[model samples]
Target: MNIIRNPKDVLSGLLFIALALLFGWQTADLPMGTAVRMGPGYFPLVLSGLLGLLGIIVVFNGLRTPGEMPTGIAWRALIIITFSVVFFGFAVRPLGFLPALGVAVFVSTLGSRLFRLQTALIITAVMVVFAWAVFIKGLGLPLPLLGPWLGGY
Candidate 1:
């Protein structure tokens, strides 16, 4: 039996395979120790292998079936999310963790159909506090609590 032959699926599969190979190649240089004590490269190597396998499966499935394919890319949401991430990266250094996170959340929430201003605010607050508490305070990741106001945390 023929599997789905959709342009979107084929493109996605190819992209996944390329990314997996890139990741695998990047991780290959890292040291891989014995099974008892895994090295830094171990997890990435395994993950890349799995990704490659999934990509192959997707490609094969696509080749075997032919059908109408819905447009895979949601450009609006994708653009919004991408910009939000970019904004987060830029704002995190200058605006501090809390404000950067709030803006990120707000920008990201704009992608959703059900987003409300109040809910976005609440979610941003919750996410910022949670991230601060968990990553900065609890895990002790040295993230900047304050921005340029205090000259870099």
Candidate 2:
């Protein structure tokens, strides 16, 4: 009797479509130039279109086939990861990019059952170094390694 055979896929497809529409709407004001002379909005609009197309396909497929519902959620991991993100957002200005990112990455790793302090430390170090290389040195973002709280300019 249910028209939607796969409820999860249908819901996810709808979510994707909604996101695509929202992004497309936001990008509408920006000028989209020709392919050869691409504008700031060009790539985003193209991506949004692709996302919408994909969502349509997913919805059709879901309606055509049956699928089991998703298993129980990973509440612990979800909570920890969410907390880490919020902490990073709040701490970034005071702690600076490197320290905030490092702490966030490390704390996020603890959300996993296979968490190891040594591994988390290594990941934190690598992520901090990579972020510094990409955002600071390569792209020349004006983020400080340390903030005013830590005597950095």
Candidate 3:
């Protein structure tokens, strides 16, 4: 008999699939233009579809794998994450995207059991590059890359 040992992956996969379906259903009415000129809902729909695909893959992987049960929720980590998101929102305008993201990541890791400033800074730096590439370059978002404090944007 096939054992689905990784219950977490299975549950998360199902949840992601549900989310994708919801997103698709909600945006069904929106025009989905060609790849060259996408409609408002085009990106969301694509993202949802990709998420659904990943969910399916995760479910399959979970089915064949053995994994431990989930432990109790980390309340401190959760609170830190929530607050870091709030920090990011406030810091974005003043500090700009990269700086705000760095600060947010640095602050968020503080609540973790394995809090490491060096690791947080390293991760934040990597994410900054990724965020810059995805948001500013790939998505052509108009977020300020550098804030006024750094120099004239």
Q: What Cα-based lDDT does every candidate model obtain?
A: 0.82, 0.90, 0.87
Give the Cα error of residue 14 in candidate 3, in Å: 1.9
- lDDT ranking, high to low: 2, 3, 1
lDDT of 1 by residue, 1-153 (tens): 345567566767888899999999999889988666778798789889899889988787778767567656678788998999999899888888777888888889998878799998888889988999987987566778779965765
Candidate 1: C-alpha RMSD after superposition:
5.0
Task: Residues 68-130, candidate 2: write the lDDT tens digits.
Answer: 676777799999999999999999999899999999999999899999989999999999999
TM-score per candidate, in order? 0.57, 0.63, 0.77
- lDDT minimum window of 10 residues, candidate 1: 1-10
Candidate 3 — worst ten consecutive residues by lDDT sum? Answer: 144-153
Clash list (residue pairs), candidate 1: 2-64, 2-65, 3-64, 3-65, 4-65, 5-65
Candidate 3 segments exceeding 4 Å error: 1-3, 147-153
Better of 2 and 3 by TM-score: 3
C-alpha RMSD by candidate, in order: 5.0, 4.8, 2.7
Expressed as tens digits, the lDDT of each residue in 1-153 for candidate 3 is 648789888888998899999998888999999899989889889999999999999889888888866676789998999999999998788778888888888888788899787898788888889998998999898999777876638
- TM-score of model 3 vs. true structure: 0.77
Give me the runs in candidate 2 sitting further than 4 Å from their true place. Answer: 1-69
Q: What is the lDDT of residue 51 in candidate 1?
A: 93
